[model samples]
Target: MSRKKEVAGSPQRAVRGPAFGYIRVSTQSQGQTGISLEAQRGAIETFSQAMGYDLIEVLDDVASGMGPESFCSRRGLRSALEAANSNNAVVIVLAWDRLTRYSKFENQLRKIAFDPNRVVCIEEVELRQNGSKAAIHKYNEVMGQRISSGTKAALDRLRSNGVVLGNPSMKTSVQPLGAQAYSRKSTDLVRQIADMLMESDDPFSVPSSTVVIKLKERGIRTMQSKEWTASRLREPLKKARRLIEEREAPEPPPTFGMF
Candidate 1:
């Protein structure tokens, strides 16, 4: 299929209304496998053409499908949903699980139903504004649970076989110095700086010079064995503050059926 130029303004409409594609893959490796982003895009685009709808845009999210937060936190999915709501268009995916695999799928179903737009999962189900056929939605929910379970089992098998998952080691030459590279001494010093700043009335107003002095007094040197300059000290302190904030952030509200 020919790639059309993405327009800057409102999406061009068709006889059947605009169609927005939403695609996702859990990991970079999944993005390269058979059920890749490209495969999903092709399916959505082809389906849109066959159904007489103008394909407006394709949004992608590289995130796991295990939880509602995974879907909620995806910027791409948010944009797609907003566009769909604005245009009263249909959102297409390769399967229902691509949207979410939450144990209680009805919560997400209800959310999509709030708007007049439809959600079309090519392989498993189609949810319309009027609502999904109860039996069909239930079947899709069961299938999603099975898929999540199987994926977890496979990951467990890989772990048992000593195959490490997640991102590879950062190359120092290509990337900034990561926390892993810092010695315990430097890490503690950075944390001390972060804590002091956090305690201040205005964290941003806490000058970098104060951090430098603290590092010098603590006899801490960077991974490169250089004296702590304001610029050199910023990244570690930033990382430390981020870690603290993440630890202090409130947990997400529980999904439906948690009670």
Candidate 2:
């Protein structure tokens, strides 16, 4: 709003040196039921001010986040990434879904040499990561965990509103398929890790190959979209063991000094 350089219709930005806003919405604009581009733009611009972003320009796309569409299909999002790379600026969004709800966007960002720190989400609770490869992977792990929670939360909300998920009255025609679809969710991955830790007497000395086999058996892949590796499992294994150790640690005796 700070006197942006406007064209006849659009604005010509690139002055303040670091920020691009990307917004995506479905076709339901003009006071529709769900969301409006105006609202998204306003929220982003306001957040930009507080975050000290120059807010070079705001590019928009009309699309639904629930689709399995690729990022290349989104011209506006692609353009925003290109522009961000050109200016070495940050790409800010109102929420993670405004960018994408899945981990696929990670490859797209890396392909264009975009820094992970530059991708900002106004409503994100996770901290941003640096441009290091390890940091990006760490960020992806955090996002992978957070992303899966939203779907279940939405379904719960629907149930609370008296909305039925599956047909309640219909009888099943076939037997239930057991573990037909493997879960790649972060929580599931953690549970697998915990199981491995419990089976090992020396949890700290447990090899990465053992954990990788467990993951493969469960059909879970790392955020990098491949079988788990030592480097990828390093942090999680240590963290999980530390957590277990903390949980099973005995409480210390009361101090000699009186309260």
True-vs-predicted CA distance for residue 247, candidate 1, Å: 91
Q: At residue 76, what lDDT does model 2 achieve? A: 85
For residues 95-162, what per-residue lDDT tens digits would candidate 1 score against the true structure? 77888778865566467653423777666434332222332344355556657877999999999999
- What are the models' TM-scores? 0.41, 0.40
Model 1 poorest 10 in a row by lDDT:
127-136
Residue 137 deviation, candidate 2, in Å?
Answer: 32
lDDT per residue, candidate 2, 24-54, as tens digits? 8756453242234555666666555544467
